[model samples]
Every structure is written in C-alpha cells, then in structure tokens.
Target: MPETTYSSDASGQGTNGSRFNRIAMALFGRQRDKLQDPFYLLLLLGFISQGFFWENTVVPIMLAALWFLLIHLSSRKYAINETTEILFLLLALLISIHFGRTAFMRSLSFGNGLLVLQAMRMLRPLTPREKCLSAGIAIVNIAVGSQMMLEYGFILVLAAALVLILQTFHKLEAESCGFHESKFSPRAKWKEFSFVVLAMIIFFLVFPRYRALSSVTTNLSIGRNAPIAPTLDPASGGMEGTGRLIFQISGDDIGYLKTFTLDTFDGTRWAAGKHASAFKRNLRVEPKPELKYRKAIVKEIALLGGSLPADGYPVALKGNFFQDDYVSWQGSIRVSRYWPADNNIYEYWTDLNKHLDADSRETASCLKHPELSDRAKKMIADTTAAAAGEYNKARALEKHLRDTFTYELGTYDLNRLNPLDDFLFNEKRGHCERFASALVLLFRQMGIPSRIAIGFVPVEKNEIGGFFNIRDTHAHAWVEAYLPDRGWLVFDATPVSDRVLQRPASGFALTMRDWVEFIWYQKIVGFTSNDQVMLYKFTAEGIDVAAEKVSRNSGIMILLTILLLALTGGIVIFRRYSAGKAGRSSSITYSEIFAEHFYRDLLRELASAGIRRVPSETPGEILRRASIKIPSAASEITFITDEFCKIRYGGRKPEEDLHDKVKSSLHAVKSAIKSRKTFATDLH
Candidate 1:
C-alpha cells in the first residue's frame, strides 16, 4: 500500500467531514445495552402513575415493583429464557383473570388487564421496535387513566409521564446512533416542552369535537350496587354505601336527582309499564300549572355506570356538547347511544314540585301486585281506611310507615322469597327502598296509581360553591302516587331522622375540595362547543362594553388609554429583559438587514424575469438552477449565491461596502435578463 499525502484543501475537507459525522452520530446513535434499564425504569414510573386512577391499589404497585426489579436484575447479565417468559405470561394471565373477576366478573374491564399485560411485556427483553410499542402501551395506560378520572392531578401526572417518555425515547435515539452518554440541560428541554404544551392547549381549544359514544353497554344488575338508573329491583341486594362521588348539581336547593321511575310491580321486581308511553308522550309536554319550574345544572364527576341523572319531571335537558339525548320511556333522560366517559354536563329545566301528569292514562299495571299477601293488602287498607281524600290517605299511609318502621342500612336479603314482607312484618327495619316499595304497594292496594322512583337525593350542599355534592351513598328510592285533580305528588314514607343523623358534617376543607372538583369538571373537562360559543359571546360583549365606556365616560376612557400605554411599556421592558438574560440583542443586526435586502432583491428579479422558486427549493439551489435559464446573468447569480451562503451559514459578518456590490449585482442580473428577452423577441 502506498502512503498518499493530501493538499491543504483536501485535509480541511476531511476534518469537516469527520466533524459532521460526529454530530450526526451524536443525534442518531444506538443506545448501549445498559441504558435499557433506565428506559424501562422510566416506563415503569409512567405505568404506575396510571394506577393512581385504578380501583385496585396493592396489585398495581406490587406488579410495577416486580417489573422494575426484574429489569434491574436482567441488566446485570442475567439471561431470561423461554421457560421464564412462559411462566411470566401465565402469571400475568392468572392475575388479570383474578382481578377481572374480583372487579367486574364475567365482563372483563381494561383497568387491571392493561396493567398486567404492560408488566409482562416489560419482563421480556425488548427490541428497538418493541421499545416503541412499549411507549405506545404506556400512553394507552395514561389515556385510560384520563378516561377514568378527569382531575387536575391526573392531568399533571399525564403531562409528567409524557415528558419522561419523550426524554427516554430521545435517549434511545441518541444511543442507537452510538453517541457517548451526556446530560441534557433541563432548561432547554423544558423550553422545547413548553411549545408542545402550548400546541396541545390550542388543539384542545380549537379542535372540533365529534361525539364518541361508548361501545360497552352498562349492565343493570341487582345487589348492594351503585344506583345507575331510576328502576330498582327488590331482588337485588340492599342499597349499600360505596362512598364514591357520582355527580354534582348546582341549584337553588338540595333536591332529589331522579333518573328513572318504575311503574309496574310483578311480585319480585318493579318495572316500567304502559306508563312509559304516557311518559314518552309527556316528554315534550309543559309542566303543570301548579308545579314550580327551576333551572339546574348537573355535572357528572365520575362514570356512574353511564347513567344520566336529572331532577324529577324534566321538561327540557341540554347537553354540554351538541349531541342527541332522549328521554327513556320510563321518564329517565338518556344519552343517545352510550354513556359519556367524564365531564358530561346537563342543563335541566326541572319541575321543582314533584307532580305527575294529570292527563296520563291510568293503567291496571300500576295497581297490580301479584305477590302481595292477603294480610299485607288488609294492612294497607286499614292504614288508609279513615282517609277521605286521596291526598289525606297518602299522607296517612306515609305517616304510618315513617312512624312504625325503623330506618337501617344493609337490611335487605336477596335470597328471601318476599323481601318486602320481611321488611314490613318481620324485620320492620329497612332502607329507603323498603319504605318506598311498601308505600307504593299500599297506594296500589287502595286503588290509587303509584310507582317507585329510584334515584339520588342530594343531601350534601357545598356551601363554598353553592353546589350539591351527590355521592353513591345518596342513592334513595321514594314513592310517587297519582292523585285526582291534583296530579302525581311525591310521598316519602322513609324516616328522614336516621339519614340526617348519618350525614357527615361538611367542613371547610371538604367544601374547598368540592369546589375544586366542580371547577375541574366545568372549566377543563366539561368545556365543549357551547363553551366555545360562550367564549366568543363574552369577547364580543367585552368589546361592546369597552366601546360604550369610551363613548359615554371620558374619565374612564382616559384611564383605559393610560392602562393600555402602561401595558405596552411593560411588554417592551419585559422583552428587553428577556433578551438581555438570554445574551441576545433585541434589535436587528447588520448581517440580518443585509440578508433581508439581498433575499428580497433576488426574489423581485426572479419574479420579473418570469422565474419562480418552488416552495421546496432553497435560495442557493434556485440561483444555480435559474443560471442555466438566464445565461447572461449567470455570473451575477453565482456571486449573489456565494455571498448569501457566506452570510447565512459561513458565520461571516456583513460589510457596508458589500451591500452596494450585492445591489449592483441584482440590478445587473435584472437588466441582462430583460435585454436577452427583448433580443429573443426581436429574433422571433
């Protein structure tokens, strides 16, 4: 092999090539095997953050810790074989099955199963493609968490997780390109991240949101479960307190939030009857003359099995977003297809006084009770026998039940043949369902049309925000009896004293927490098409107000002018301060001024000469390509291209004398092209 010596220019070119290669490697290098551990750790943190919204606590934490330890140990040169992978998969499957059964039973939920699979995936060694897929899985976990709970804390956690994931991927890219380990400046990373956050906020505000209906239909089941609808099945277990917050309402008074009404009693279960037709007919009907109507806003804080809650006899319901929501045949207002995930606000015009429609056709189904014992029928007859008017009889029956029966929680047994019989005669102690059911049966026995209204009673009033905080524990069932001439009136047979005593005292802390939750749902999660419209309306209103003030009040106008001037001065000072802190000048420099003029001249000359630059073509590339079309101006064009490249990329300072030279070159190029065109025209 012969040793070859290169000239100075060749040596300089080689140095520049090596430097470019080094920079490229720094940006796109492959990460070391050891770096995988840290990447996995970041992913583990993101996965565990999602668990904060899950129902199960211990399992998610344990799985995350196990996965983290496994990754750490594996990084120390421990080989994971096929047997270990199989065992891990089996363990994940078993855990998912167990958690799914414990949480939702035969219908598996994505909550536990998602976490289990993510952990299992992390357990195995990952390829570059697998790592990207893992990042995607982590994002899905975050998305699920967001769907589960739309809170400020959840948003914060999601943003943090996203930043961590992005940094991890950035590191992976750097490592893959063979770059040595280096620490990225937090300030610079945050500066870049700020733009991403701004873009997301803009998209959230401006993007047109189409309604997405839920695919999963909520199963209405029985037994000590959260109230999802107005219909109650006595065969289901007693209503137990889950202590989960369901929804919040803002109204003048704390009232019952009715979701459904059960009209037919067929021994074991109360269901919707022919009254559904009457209810549906009256869905668009106006309230009775005697009923007082009030406006109420219901904001769903959490998913209560996808059920929409509203006050009794809702005349009108408006969703936060533009979507079709209809009233169920049973008088419950339901979302068209699926239940909304979170932040679904409904504006309802509710009849404050619970009055049933007077025009509704009375059916035998409301009075039919196939399983009612003869003794129970006689007891109901005795209770309302002395009452002359239907109202008096209803009041007497309500008083009798409230005075005699004791109110207690967790008293109903699903196994009993007739739980109502046990509640009325044997046990004599039951929750609102028993009281309501007993009252309804008594009314039916007296030949009065009656039904059970199953829904939430807003008991806790958030004094701070003037909103009612309704929880699952507030679920109650009551009776509604149809009265002649007076329409249907609410008759509560349940003792109120026990429930009042059981109510927790609302403190300042609790009030503030409720206020925060209300704000979170209304301002952030609940923002919709209506909000965007309202925003524009508000801005327009503000402008009109400002104009009016300017026209009417000279003193106020002067103050406004002063304030505007002050604001402008403040902005100027702040920008100057920022530029100084960043070690940059706020004013344009000589090079920038020269570059701007040169660029504009080149564009104007090219446009006049019938030469246009494509969007994708650079200035230097355009100049060289256009030189062939205008040969007479080739030298001027080349000179401009070289000068522009020097000023733009060679870090050379612009000289005052070079500015005139550039202008002369541009003028010469333009004149030469014109002359060539005229000569060609004459020849033709």
Candidate 2:
C-alpha cells in the first residue's frame, strides 16, 4: 500500500499465462468450426443400409439423397445457418407425417423409430455430442438388424459398422488431444477391437435369455387386400400369377405348404370356426399323433400372408418372436399374428406322410357344412356310388375332379350364387381353388370328413440349394379327407399336369445366393435353446464314450504311454549325444565350454563345504549367498558367477583367454571352501 508499484516481471508472467490459456482452449474446448466430420458419413451409410431390410423404399431413397447433399455441403465447407436448420426441421416434419399417413393407410407397421430419427439427425451439422448420438443410433440399427436377419452378410455388415463407429470415437479422442494423427495404427487398433467383439459374442452366447412378452398384436389378414382368415372364395378374383418369391423350403422332399384348413362351407365362402383356439388347444394337450416325421426349414423371403406357411402336419415349429402366435391342429397350423416381412426363419418337423385315427370331435367338425345344393348333392352321390370304403370314395371324387376339370386362371364366376356348383357343373375349367372346393364338398356330402387347405405347393426345387423356392404363383388349394383307420390324407384334386408344370430355372448367382441363405438359416439363425441342449448332451456323451473305450483297453493304453515316454527319452539322449560330439570338435565357443565347467565345479565346491546349491536356486544366486559364509573367496566367486551368467543368459561369447581366467577363479573358490571345511573338522 505504501509503494503500490507493479513489477515488469509479474506483468510479463501474467501475459504468458493468458496466452497459454488461449492455446489450451483452442486444443480441448468444443469446436464450432465444422458442420460435421467425415467419419460421421460412415454412420450415415450404416443407417441407410438398414432401410433395405424394411418394406419402405421412399423413406430410404429420400434419406439417401439428403445424406449425399449433406456430404456435398460438408465437403465444400458450407456452414449451416438458422434458415437452413429451419428448412431441415420442416422437411423432417413433413416426412414424419407422410410416413405415418402411409403406414396408416396401408396398415403397415412402423418398427423401432430410429431409422427416421437417424435420417433427420443427418440433415444438420453435428457437434461432438450429436456425433456421439449418431454413433449410438448406428449401433442400435445393427442390433435391430441382428434380431431381424441373422445372415452371415448381415453379421459382416454389423462388424464393419462397429469398426467404423469405434474409428469415429478414436478420431474424436485425437481431436481432443490436439493431435491430427491417430494414437495407434488402424491395423493395431482393429486387432485390439477384435477382442472386444469376441467378448461381446461370448456374452451373447453364454448369457441366459428370456422371451419378452409381445404387446403388439399383428393384423392376421391374409394379404394387404385379402381376408383375415384364409377362405376358399371362388367368387374372389383369379389367383395372383406373379412369380415373386414368397418363402423358401429346405427339406428332403417338397410338398404342399399347408397353412390353414377350412371346414365350414357357408354356401359361398369356406371358413374355419374357432380355428385359432382349435389349433392352440390341440397342440398343447394332444400327444403328437403316431406318424413318421421329416424335418424341414422354412424361411420367409417376402411377405405372402398373415399366417406362417408350412407343409401339412407340422409337429413342431422353431422361430423367434411368434413362437406362441401359431397353433396346430388336424395337420394344419394357424398363426394369430402377421409375420415380419424379412428374415422370419422357422424349422418345421412335419409328417409329410401323415397317418392318423381322427377323434369323434375332429371328424364331426370336418363333416359339418352348410346346406348343399341338389346339384352338388347329386354329383357327390354319383362320384362315390361305385366306390367301396371312405378312402376309395375320397380317391374316386379326387380322380373325377382331376379327370373332368381343366385348370384355368381368372375364369371364376364372381356373381354366381354357388361358386362350387358353377365350377363343377358349368365352368369345368377353373384354378386349383375351384377343383379343391368341389372335391372337399363332395367328400363332406358322402359322409367322409374333409376340409380345404390353403397354402403354396413347393414344386420348384433349386438344384444348387436342394430346397424349394416357393413363389406367390405357387399358392394353391387342396383337399385333406379323413378316413376310417388312417388320419387326414392329403388329396389334391388339382390336375397333375397343371400342378407339375416346370418352373423357370434359377441362374447360378441366384442359386448360390439361396444356398448361402439356406446355410445361414440352418446353422446360425435356426440354432435355438433346444439345439444348444442337444449339442451339450452330444458333447458329454462323446466324452463318456471315449472314457469307456479307454477303460476297456487299459492295457493297450498303458503300453502306448510307456512307448511314448521311451521315445521322448530316446530323443532327448540323441540330442545330448549330438551336442557332445559337436563340443568335442574344435568348433565349440569358449563361453559355452566355460559356462558348463564353471557351473559343475561351483556345485561340487558348495557340496564339500556342506552348503550344497538347491535345485531351485540358480548358480549365480547360490554363489552370491555362499560368499557371506566364505567371505575370503568372495571376489573370485563373484567373477566366476558373472562369467557364467553372461554366457548362459546374456548370450555373451567370451575370448578363449577369458575361459582360462574363469577356470582359475573357480579353482581359488574351491580351495577356499576346502580349507574352511578342514578347519571346521579340526575344531570338531
């Protein structure tokens, strides 16, 4: 207070501190210069890739265009202003509304809303926080994809996405450290990252999983414009002849892919009553009927209908989300919920040749139908008149329809009062639906329990994959008649010539793609908890069998062990003999000779002094400790020990003259130890 004088030194120090603070801020503080980093583009591409799995094409296309524009803007260093932000926000709002409206109009589901949000987030320049958000969204997208489609291609994509995401974080850390170069090489970083991915896979496999209760009820409508339940409505328009792929079937033999069977014919449309309940109840309580089963794997490539398609008489099904959605009864399965459009893999154990004795209730349900027209009644009576038993009667009706009717598409009488009657009497040339409907009604009227089954007939087997590639064009209807002793036997009244038409052969590339997809579905996607248990049991049984065999051949095993030990000893002795011969030659180094002789001489001296070196203790360590008891020869002991250590561990090649010096040092130490032992004996 008295002087109040500022020093030039203090002022200079203050100025320097302010400059350092500014530099630190420039390095570590949040950057506001760039709109977004180039690494974020990898995240954008990953997000865009997931859209291909969805049915929405417009959203993905728009998002892709927007992303390209953003990348262009970022490359040109175009800064986003308030106007740009507002425009992007408005565009996002419009897209959301359009998506919501389209989803509502078409009755389509809006799955995890991340895809839309990711697209919107990509529109603006991202800060560090926003980049982190984008990375998280990309990770979630990969996780969602794994659940939807567990293909090997998808797994590869997921791995790439993870690497890109990690690289982005690594770049962020570099930027924070004020370094333009990466801390680690890309190859090195990825090698370390591979372990992390391996750990994640291990956790996924070993962690216990529980089925989450699904809250969303899928619309069980057959198709976009089709009925809720499968109907044999001959009044409906002709079959969809599009050759678009619907599903794939992998098994030994292909057959009719049966979904639902309709029993009640209400004069116009054939419908199943309480079909969902019937299937669920039958599967829950009933023992799988005594029938031989052939296992098949089915994968939905495109959405065909609401219910899951399978061969007739599915004994069991393996899938992910819709395990409880389906019910099985009377050689048919009815799904209560709609299937996802992509990667819905299911394994079916079906009785391809089902033989069952139907209960009274099932027989009655199949026989019950609406009032039949006199024309229909007369036709049924005539067809089954000459036939003896129910089986023969069903076969007779099936043969009559096949022989009399000709297959024609888009020839249905929509306005007719009785579609089946029109098909049988007037229009003898109709699709499989008409023929199947006629045969089913005829069997019912003849006191034979029968139902019409609606599903695809997998006739086109891929030569490369050895599996059937079912298409929408293959959607067919057939009859299943209940006999006296045997169960419901599949009776397709559709003409064999029409049903057995040759399908267009698949190209090599397409066939190979299908083969890869089939392997993925069978080995990876189809592996369930039951399969895991089976694998565990199989491994344990193998171990037990191996142990039992070893025990049974105990004498042989002991002889083998002895022979192995003898061979190993002989090899060691041969190596030592070879080394000895090499040493006897003048080519042996001085260090090697000194190291061997010095170690053996030191051990012998220590033993004479009644202080033998233990096996666990090294020569150098023993000499150092022994020096305390025999201090007079400490210097010589230290020199010899150092020489041995250099030769043995340090790989040092001493001069030939140094070998003589080491020998002299060992001699002095041995004489000192012998003199000490003699003095001790004289005192005793």
Candidate 3:
C-alpha cells in the first residue's frame, strides 16, 4: 500500500582511482607509479575490446594507446609504467600483424597479441569502450585460432589471457568515474570471476568445430620445387619414400604399405599394369601350411591426411579393407584419385599371414641374381619342375640363396648400366630392392607371375594410439608370386638383420605427433558427410541396423530420439512429483515474512532520510538511528524493527496483523520523510 522513501548522505566520491592504480600496479608486478593504473586499465580494456568485437576500430584505439605511450615515455624516463606500456602495445601489434595472414604463424601471433594487449592495458588502461574492444578482439583470435589450430597449448594461452583481462579491467567501470573500491569488493570480484569462467566454458563446449585437419598436413609440401625426373631410390622423390614418416603399423606381425598396383608388367619391369576389368576376376594364390607356423596379422589402415599414394588407388584388399559400394579391388585396393589433403582417415585392413610359401623360396634365389646366368636359370627351371605338382620348389631356391649370398645395402650406384648385374656378379650382396627384383625375374623365368613390390614394412609402434611408424629408412622391396587358389602370395626375401629394422630414438615422438596429426586430419580437415555418418554409426556402437539406418538417413531415428527424450522427461517429472508427495511441503508465518518486507522498507526510508545504510548494515542499528532522528515514528518503527529482528534471530512466528502493521508503519515513515521534504532536497 505504501512506497518507501529512500535517501543517503552524499558520500564523498572516494579517490578509488588512486587505490585501483596501486592495486593494478601490484598485480602486474610493476613498480607503483602515477601512470600504472591508467596503463593497466588500458591493457584490460584492450582484452575486453578484442574478445567482444574485432573491428578495424581496434587499430585506431591501439594507435591512440601508442601515442599516449610515446608522450608518457618522452615525459617520464626509465619508469616501468611508461616503458612497459609502450613495449606491450608495440609487441601486441607486431604479433597481430604477424599471425593475421599466414596459417602456420596465426596461432602464435594471436596468442602473443592477447598477451601484449593485456599487458598494454595493465600499463596504460583505457575507457570501458576500449576494454570491450580488446575483449572482442580476444574472442575473434580465440575463435579463429581454435578453428585453424586447436591444441591444448592454445587452451593454456586462452586461460592466461582471461586472467590478464580480469586483472586490468575488472574494477574499472564503464563510466570511468575514477575507479570505485566497491567494484572490487570480494563478493563482486568472485561473482565476475565466476561469470567469466562460465562464459568461457559454454563457448568451449557448444561452439561448432571446424572440419578435422589433414593428418597428411604434417607432410605438406612447404614450397619445395618438384624434381625434374625423380629416381626409384628412396632418396629420390619418385620411387622415393615419403620423407615424412607415416604412422607405424605393428603387432606380432609386420605389414607392407601398398602403393599403386602395376598390373601391366613390361619385359624388363612391372609397367602400367591395367586393372583386371571384371570385378569377379580372381587371381589365385596359396601357401602350404605345414612348412611354416601361421598367424595372419590383419592391419587396420586408416588413411590419415595426405594425398593417396601418387597413384589413385583404393588402398585395401577385398574382404580385408572394407565392404562398401565404392570400393573395388584391382589385384590390390586402388583408387583412381589421390586422397585429398583435407586430412581424412580412411579405414583399410590387410592380412599379414606368416608363411614360408613356395613363392618366397624362389624369390630369395632369383633376387640373388643379375639376370639369372644360364646356370642359375637352369637351376630355377629344375627346382620349379621338381616341386611342380604339389611340392615346394621356391623353398629350395630360398635355401640356396641363404647359404651363398650375404645381405647388404647400398653397394652400387643406381645410375650405373645394369645395376642389378653389378649386385649379382661383382657385389654378391644387395638390399631388398635389388634382391626382390632379381628374385621376381627369376621366378617369372620359371613361369610364375612374380613381381617386385616396393613400400616400407612398419617397424615401430606408438603406444598411445597404436599407430605404425613407417619411416623412409624402412623403405623395402618384397615379392608377390601368384599361387593357384589363394591369389597373390606375399613373401619377404630380406634377411632378418637386427640393424635392418632399427627403431630410431626420435621414432616415438614422431609417432605420437603423427597420431595427433591423424586426429586433426580425419576429424577436421577430411571430414566428409560420409565420415559424419560413420562417426554417428560408431557412436551408435555395433548395432548394424542402427548403423545402416543412420547411413541411409532414416528419419525413424529422429522419432526414436524424440520418444527417448519424452520418456526421460516423464520419468523426471514423476520422480519430482513422487518426492514432493513424500511430506516435502514448506510453510512460513506472516510476521516472519513481514520481516523481509520491513527490512527492505527500512533501508529505503533511511536512504531517503539522508542516511542510507551500507549493503552490509544490520536492521536493529538502522532502526535505532531512525528512531533518534524521528521520535514521532520511533515506537512504531522500533516495534517493527524489534519484531523483524526477533522473527529473524529467534524464528518467532510472523502474524497477518503484524504484517499489516509493519506495512502501515513503513507508509508513515515514508510520509514523514516527504513531509520534511528530505527525499526531494538532499539528492540535489
């Protein structure tokens, strides 16, 4: 029924600005000086401005800051206040410019800019408008930087920037009416801090992420010129291995990296090798089990972010890599196009079956040759015929080569005429490339469609993500001889030398980096609609129908989701109702309730009467003082105040009559203030 009249004594506009200057200087770890508060506030404002808005206006603001710094520097010599602000602003501008354009350099620049801006504000603070500008720019930097290169490292920089922003601008009001201590009061400080943290968390969790970066981005051709004619050597870019180590594949068995399949073999080499036109064409291969202990190590290959091997080929064997409409086998998994650089991880599987197959034996012997001498050729023919029907002739050849030749790497210059001849006749030793090639030719001479395959065997494995690290040094050549029923049987002719598969010390770090790179590529850069579907499927776990429905874009799933949400809501509502019914009612009397109303009215009356109570003041004291000022309402006000105190302190019952009386008393107090014209005159 009554509006409370409020008043407060005109409190002196405290020199809060000076106190802020001292506190800000203390926080920035700078020596106390006249300019410190201004500088610190500038830095704080810069951060706020950057985080909230990133417009060209920031440039002018920065320029103004610079001009101020310059003036301060000219006037004050060697003072921390002046020098630091200049340095911070200059550094921030430099970092912003540096990372503003280039992709690789952007993260560093953006992070530095935040630090510089914050430091600058700390050194020479700005208006609230400027603080907002800085905070806006910070948001732009953080949002863009995360999309470009989101790493845990960037997270750390963001946290630091947030802290700097708080220290610089938290106490400075938008009005810039020389800082106020109440603004930094512990309660307010904590409240602001909590709000900032909550905002950052929401930004982090809900912000939509960009496509995953390419795993192959790590192997980006950073401005390197293409070679005129690359050689087949690992050192050359042609048949050369990727200098960047692809993640390793390892288990109990080693696996080979599949390059493009050469179906068309020329007399001297396996050439263009056209794809077997018909999908049903099966080239038979088989290896006897009795000769060797068996274990098929199937490698699950995820093509990370790099161009598919130079030749576009689907990368995995049928029944092993994937079963999908798009996949087709050409002797090997091959794609007609290179994998895109938008880092994608394509899953492929390969069976690593251990076997000393017939083809393997023949490969060892032939690889030991230049172009099999007449004697060597005859030996191969005889071995092939002796074990013709069902026995193993390849094994015999393998035994002979093992007994005679030694394993060696890098004996002959590749440019030399008939390099294989040099290895076979003069050197009598060579690495897998020379050996595998020779063996393949020898096997072909004996009527086997054996050919040389080049790629690295995975050597070391990363523990964190189980990635195989296939290095340039791991580049190897092996043989694949066609068998009758099983298709092409794989065989390695390289002698198992301890040094051959040396795991470099840097391999572990490189592997870990590759795994991270892989994540970036598949999740960000190479994320296709297909990948999204797969991710949804995987998240759905192994429910095939669910996966199929998801892949097919079945809207039935949406209905299911809605049903699930409704059921969950119904359950929650039921639980709340059931809990409420279990004797959970709450009740309070009228006098007890009136105490709250009386307290608020008393505060307003005192404020109008030119003696506003501080936020922390108690009710009894205000009532006692109000009674002294206006004796006419003293008894009534004291009765209300005493009852309010009793209800609050002693949990006394609040009555309806008491509540009505308190209301009447509050109206009378307001009328008294107005009659004396206390509400109208003091504020003026």
Candidate 2, 1-684: lDDT as tens digits? 132432224234323456654443344232211224436656555556555434345655665666555544443344556565456555644654555433332222222355555555555556555666777766765554344344466676666766677677776645433334245566767786987789876664555233222234465545544322356676665654667666676665556677667777777887765642365432333225353333345444225454566665566665643535455455555555543423455555666665666777777788776677898888878888999988887888889888877877677465567676667777788777777777877777778888888777777777776777776677778888877788768898888744454466778898898788766665455555655665677889999998999899999989999999999999999999988887666434655766877777877777778778776655545765778889999898777776666555444566668767877887898889888988989999
Predictions ranked by TM-score, top down? Answer: 2, 1, 3
Question: Stretches of candidate 2 above 4 Å error?
Answer: 1-216, 219-224, 227-229, 235-237, 251-254, 274-306, 315-318, 323-331, 335-355, 359-361, 368-387, 412-426, 497-502, 518-527, 531-684
- 52-115 in candidate 1: lDDT tens per residue? 4444567458757666455545434445664665576567556656554223221333444555
User: lDDT per residue, candidate 3, 395-449, as tens digits?
Assistant: 5555555446666654545434444445445665666655665566666666665
Reference-based lDDT, residue 407, model 3: 67
Better of 1 and 3 by lDDT: 1
Model 3 alpha-carbon drift over 4 Å, by segment: 1-137, 150-152, 161-208, 212-254, 261-373, 382-386, 389-391, 394-404, 413-422, 497-499, 504-599, 602-684
Q: Worst lDDT window (10 residues) for model 1?
A: 26-35
| Clash counts for all predictions | 13, 1, 94
Q: What is the C-alpha local distance difference test score of each model?
A: 0.63, 0.63, 0.48
